[model samples]
Target: MLATPPPYPSTIVTSTNHPEPPQITIKPVDRRRILASLAATITPFFSPHYPHLNSDQFPHIPVSFLPVANARGLFQMPPVRLSNRYFLVRAGESEFESLGIINTNPVAKTSVDNGLSTIGKKQTVKAALRLKEMGACDNSCWIWPSITQRAYQAAEIIAAVNGVNRSNIVPEYSFLDARGLGAYEGKALQSVSEIYASDLVSPDIKPPPINDGTPNESVADVFVRVTQLMSILETQYSEDTVIIVSPDSDNLTILQAGLVGLDLRRHSELAFEPGEVRFFDPSSIPTYKQPASALYKCPNPPSCK
Candidate 1:
C-alpha cells in the first residue's frame, strides 16, 4: 500500500507467529527466472491433470518480494504494533472449489448457489468448535467475516458455538474476499495457477479483463485492502481476541504475510487450508532472538540448522 516505507527503528516489527520471516539472500529473487526454473515444481498444481498433486507439494524456500506490484507496494510495510490478539481463518470449501471450477464475482459468490457445500458446512462447524474448545471467544472477542456467504455463515456458526453476541460479529465486505480470479471465473479450478504464476511476476499486474465480469486482481490489490483491514482492527480493538474469517486461502495467507513481514510475493507459502484457524498473540512476542552465531557458534541462520 505504501511506496516509501515509514520510519524504521533499526529493527523491523514482525508478527509473533513468524519468528524468522523471509529475508534478502545472496542472489536476489528474479521473479521471471524463478517461475521459469520452478515450472516443473510449481506449474503442476494448477493443472487439472495433476489432481494428485498437493497444494504444498515441495519444500518451499522463501522468495524475495520483488515482482513489484503497483509502483509503490506492500512489501515495504512493517508489521503493526497490535493492541489485540488476532486469529486468521478460512471459510469452508465452497461449491465451486469442491466442483473443480472457479468463481470470484461478488454477485455470484454471495448467492446460495456458490455457498458452502455439505462438506464445507461440516468443516466450518468443526472450526467453530475448535475456537470454542480454545475458549478464544469466551470473553470480549470480535468476529469479522468477509462478505462471502460461506464466510458469513462460518462466523454465525462460531458465534453460535461460543455464545458470542450477534452484534459482536461484523461482516467485512472488502478486505477479506476471495482473491478475484478476474477473467478466470467459471473456468476449471486448476486455472488458479495461471493467476499465481502472474502473481510471482508482480502484484500490480491485473488479470486480463474478460466479458465484463469479475475483473481479475493483482496481489497488491489484495495487499492494500488487507492493510486497511488490519489498521482498522488494531485501531478499534485492544487486549481482546479478534477472529477474521476469510472466504479463501489467499486472503489469510496474504494478510499473514504482511503482518509477519514476509516478502509479499512469497505469500502463497504461508497457506491455510479451508476452515483452518491460526492466531497472532502479541502478548507472546519476544523482545529478541539471539543470532545463530551466538546460539550454535555458526556464522548465519542457514548454518545454524
Candidate 2:
C-alpha cells in the first residue's frame, strides 16, 4: 500500500514525532564565591556613588529628563505641581554596607522608641514630619518597605512621624531584596562582595523565611510593584498621593529599568541614601510604562505567611 509508505527512514520516522527535549542551558551565576570578588567586579566598573544634581546646576538637563534607556517606552502622566505632591525621600546618608549590616536580621524592640537608634531612625521621623508640614498627611497615604529590617524600620519611623496608624500604611514588602538579578532567596541578601569569593563564601545557601524555595524578588519585580502601587493609588484618588520608599541605588536602578521598559543593561546608575528624599511628580514628565504584572509576584512564599 502506497509503496510501503516509501520505506520510512529509521532516523526520520522516530525523530519526527518525538524530537529530543531542548537542552536546558543554565549559565552559572556563582562565578565568584567571595563577597570581595563580586564587589570588586561591580563597584569598579559601575561606581555606585554620584553627587546629587540640582535643577539649577543642570540647566541643560530638564528637571525631568528620561534616562536614555527608558526614553522610547515612556508614558505621559499629568503635570506635577509642588503644591500637590510631597517629596519621596530616601532615608539618611548612611553607607550601603553599614545599613545593610545593621538591619540584616529582624530585631525585637521592647521600647519601639523612634529616637533610640544611631542608624538614622530619629532623623527619618523628622523627615516625615517635614512632609506632613507640607500638607501631605492623609489616611490614604502609602508607605512601602523592602523586606529588609532597615527599610521596614525606616518606613515605620516615617509613619510614626506622620502619626499614620499601622492600619493606614500600605506595606509593599515585595519591594525588598536589593539583589539586582534574580536568584534564590535567603542567599540574595548577601552583599555583592560576600557572595563571589571562594574562600570567604559559605557553603550553604540560606533559605528565606518564605520556604517555597523561590529566588528573592528581582529588581524587575520591585519596579512592577511600584508601578502597580502607583496605579492603585491613582485609581483610588484623583488627587496627589504621597509614597514613601526605602531603596538604594541598585534597587532604584532596577526600578528605573523596569519603569522605562528598557533592557537591564540600558539603565543609568542610581544611588539614594537613607533619609534622603527625592520627589517624582509623574505629572511633570512623560509617564514611564509600568512593568507587566507577569514579572511581579509576592516575594514571600506561603511558608512565610
Candidate 3:
C-alpha cells in the first residue's frame, strides 16, 4: 500500500504537491519589550521646559521671533523651521472620539469613564493599513502614553503585516494629553456640547467648572506646550523623518502651531478628526527676519530711542 509509506524512523515521506514551510527562528530576548521599556524611561527627560524668568528680564518670545539657520551652532537653526519633516496623526477613535458618554464627575449618579480604553480592532487595523499605504512604515513613530496601548498595538500589527522590525516604535509625552474634560471628561460630547456651548466655543475661554477641585488646562496652555515640543523636535530630528500620535485637541494645537504662528485665540478655529494624518514642513513657512531695531530695544525708557 503506497510502497509501505517508507520506514517510520529511517525515512520520511515527501509531499511533492505541497511546498515546505519557511523556517522561523525565535530570539532568546524580546527586543520589542526592551526598546519600549527604554523609551518609557528616557522620554520624559526630553520634554522641553519653559523657564519662569521675569518678563522684563526675558520677554516671552514667539516662535516666529527666532532666526533661521541650517548649520549646527548656537543660533544655527530656526526654532520653528525644522530641517526635516514629519507627520502628525490624530490617534484613532476611543470612546471620546466616537461621541460616547464619559463621566468625569466621580460623585455623579452616572459615569462611564473607562480610563485607558482603546478603540475597536477593526478601526485599529484600518488605521494601520492607511499608515502603511501612506508610507509611514518607512519611518519610526512617536506616540503619547494615554493612547499608547491602541497606537502601539496598531504599530505592531503594521510591522507584522509588513515583516518590519517592531523596535522602531517609541513613546513621547511632549504632546499634552487630551484636554482635561474636568466635569465634562466623562460626559457625552453631545450633552456637553449642548450644555456648554459658550465655553466650548473657545477652549481658552472660561474653562469647564472644576470637578472635585480638579482644574483643566486651557487651550492656550496646549498651544504653548505644543510650540515647545515643535521646537524640540526641529532641533533633535533635524535630519530624520518621524511620526507623532496625539489626541484631537493636541493634534489641532500642533497644526495651529505650524499654521497660525502659535496664537492661542486662533486655536479654536482649527479642527481635526480622529485618525486623520497631516503633514507639516516647517521649511515651507517663510522665516521672519527680525528687524535690527527690534533686536536690541532700548531698555532705559525712551531716551535711547
Angstrom error at residue 198, model 3: 5.0
Q: Point out the higher-scoring one by TM-score: 1 or 3.
A: 1
Task: Give per-residue CA lDDT, model 3, range 1-305, as digits (tens).
Answer: 56754332343335668746644444477887676555444433443442332234434433233233345433222243555656666555654445575433223211233222355445555655776787764664543222344444444554565445656555554453455556566566665444335445664654467647534656555555666666666656656656665544444544445443644444444555555656765655656788786798776887885
Model 1: lDDT of residue 34: 65
lDDT of each residue in 1-305, candidate 2, tens digit only = 45544232223333657887544444455654444344433333332232343334443443224132111222222222122343456654333344343222222111133112465665567667766776566545656655455556667777787777777556555543443322322242354433323212332222233434334333334455555644544444445555656544445554444444445443333445556565654454444455677566766875442
For candidate 3, the clash count comes to: 4
TM-score of each: 0.66, 0.43, 0.56
Q: Each candidate: what lDDT? A: 0.76, 0.46, 0.51
Q: Model 1, stretches more than 4 Å misplaced?
A: 1-76, 281-305
lDDT of 1 by residue, 1-305 (tens): 86885443334436668666544335355898667556545554545454455326533523331121222122224453566778878988888789988888887768997788899999999999888887788776899999898899899988998899999999998788788877788889888787777777876778887775685778888988788887787656657799999998888877777766677778888878888988765544334455576766555857664
Order of candidates by lDDT, top first? 1, 3, 2
Q: Candidate 2: global Cα-lDDT? A: 0.46
| Ranked candidates, highest TM-score first | 1, 3, 2
Instruction: Compute the lDDT of residue 19 as modeled in candidate 3.
Output: 48
Evaluated with TM-score, which candidate comes out highest? 1
